[model samples]
Every structure is written in C-alpha cells, then in structure tokens.
Target: WLVKKTPDRYEVKIPARIFHEYVAFMRARINKGMGVAEDAIWSAATECLFLTSSARTKKDIEDNIEREVIGKTIGKFRNKYRSALRYGILDSAPDIDVLLLAKEIDAAVVANDFGIQKWAEELGVRFVPAKTFPLMLKEYLKQRSSISHSTKSDFFDDFEES
Candidate 1:
C-alpha cells in the first residue's frame, strides 16, 4: 500500500503566555536564515501555530521588544489571515487552552509549561517542548518543501539521514 504524501498544511496549538515568545523566536530564526522568505515564514507560522490567551497572560508580556515582535508577527497575521487566531470562551485558565485547542484541532501542542504538558499527555495529545519546537518546525518546513519539489525515489530516506 502506498503511504499518502505529506499534507501541505499543519497546525500547532499554544497558550497565550507562550505565544509571544514562540512568535518572536520563530521570526528571529527565519530572518537570520537564508533562502526562506519573510512572507513565507509568516505564512507558515500563522498556519501552523495555534494560540489562545487569557487576559492575564496577555498582560504579563513585559518587554516592549518582545511585545513588538509579537504584534508584528502574530498580531499582523491575525488581522491579515482572520481565521488563523481561534477564539472561544474559556471553561478554565488560559493555559489549558493549549491542550484544549490541540485536542480540538487534532494538532500538537508546543509549550514549556509543565502543567500544560502534564494535562496534554493525560489527554493523549502530542506535545513538544517550547525550546525545541522552532527547530522541529524549521525541519518540518524544509521536508515539506522538498517533498513538493523533489522527484528522487530515495528522498524520504535522504531526508531522514540529514
């Protein structure tokens, strides 16, 4: 049986507390890297990252620089993409929203918070630590682009090796 090709789009849900940091980190890495265009980076981030915030989490962002980056990246994407930001009434704290959204979307949750991770695991949701999520995403994007363009029979094998 032939395995299906990788889908062009994927989503990751995150808490609002981590949202600002994640966006900032991703934007910096994409900007510093060569080949990947800024437009495509934003598109990827918007499509892949899921975020829901409580008012408290939104208020906790203290650094102006970080807030600015978040605003420019996630904030702009929300306005431009419209549907990328998922908003709903919370039955609990905003942190749980990560797990809730992940389950809702059938997507992975990228978070550093222990509480979120624990709850996510209990719910049988896929979870990735925040520290490594950026690298994983970058690799995912690379593989996705390759699959779209590569005709090599061993492309998947080569990707695994690299």
Candidate 2:
C-alpha cells in the first residue's frame, strides 16, 4: 500500500490465478465468521481481474473439477465470480497479459507467483503481493464509503495542492 502511482486513480493488473485466490479468500473470510460482505468480495472481482483468453478458458476447467467429478456446484460459485471479469482485458499471454496491462496503464500488478515476479522485475513493473491486497482493498473501500459527497471536490481537484 505504500506504493503510489503518478496518476492517483489507476487500475491494478490481476492475474487470473490471483483473481481465483481472491474469491476463495473472500469465501473463506465469510465462512470463517468474519463479517465480510458478498458485494465487497464481488466488487474486488470486478475491480482488477485480468486474464489471457486461454488462461480464462483454463481457469474454467480448473474450477469445474468439483462439479464434474463430485456432483457439486463449486463451478456455479466460480462462474459467478468469473462472470465479473467479462469486461476484463483479454490479451494473449505467456502469462504476460498482467505485465502488458501494468505497462500500458502504469499500474501495479497484484500477484505472488515467482514467474510473474521474475517477469515483472525484468520488465520494471511494480507489484504487490496477493496476500495483502484483500485487507488493503477492504480498508480503502471502507474509507471511500465514509466520504461525504457534499464535502467532496471534483475528481481533478483531488490533485490540486491544498
């Protein structure tokens, strides 16, 4: 969270694996007696998820294991979260889609995979670990939700010197 962008408002580049991890983390938090909102979890899904077209298809296959083998509805839960990425940028990859988006938008990549880290370092892309993102994001949203519209200035005014 100490990392800051040159532009104040920016998108984050999320790998599909990290996106799935986020959904599982959110589900675990809710199921483990944490008072997390479903929308908060889904909103995270909507915010930064990204994948190559091939990875997206592969992810669906991974998520279908329970449904296909165990006659369970895990795929339904996964599908709900996956649908949130319909508007996500679908690029081609050697898992370079995250790097490409991060470079394009000067955005940070939310990922923890060693391969992604290696590529990001080689490309000079900024990154944050996936493990900390959920708490950081929840806090950010909490602060944002507390802002009073009447007291707020125009979006660009936020960049002005106080």
lDDT of 2 by residue, 1-162 (tens): 597648533355556567545545654554443224344544444332324223454335443442353332334554554445322322224346677678778998888565566667766888778999999899988878767552465554765855
> Each prediction's Cα lDDT score?
0.59, 0.55
Model 2 regions more than 4 Å off:
1-94, 149-162
- What TM-score goes with each of the models? 0.36, 0.34
Residue-by-residue lDDT tens digits, candidate 1, 1-162: 999876553345455557545545654554444224445655454433323323244334345634465447765554544333222212234555666678889999887666667767877899899999999989999999898777564787788899
RMSD of each: 23.0, 21.5
| lDDT of candidate 2 at residue 13, scale 0 to 100 | 56
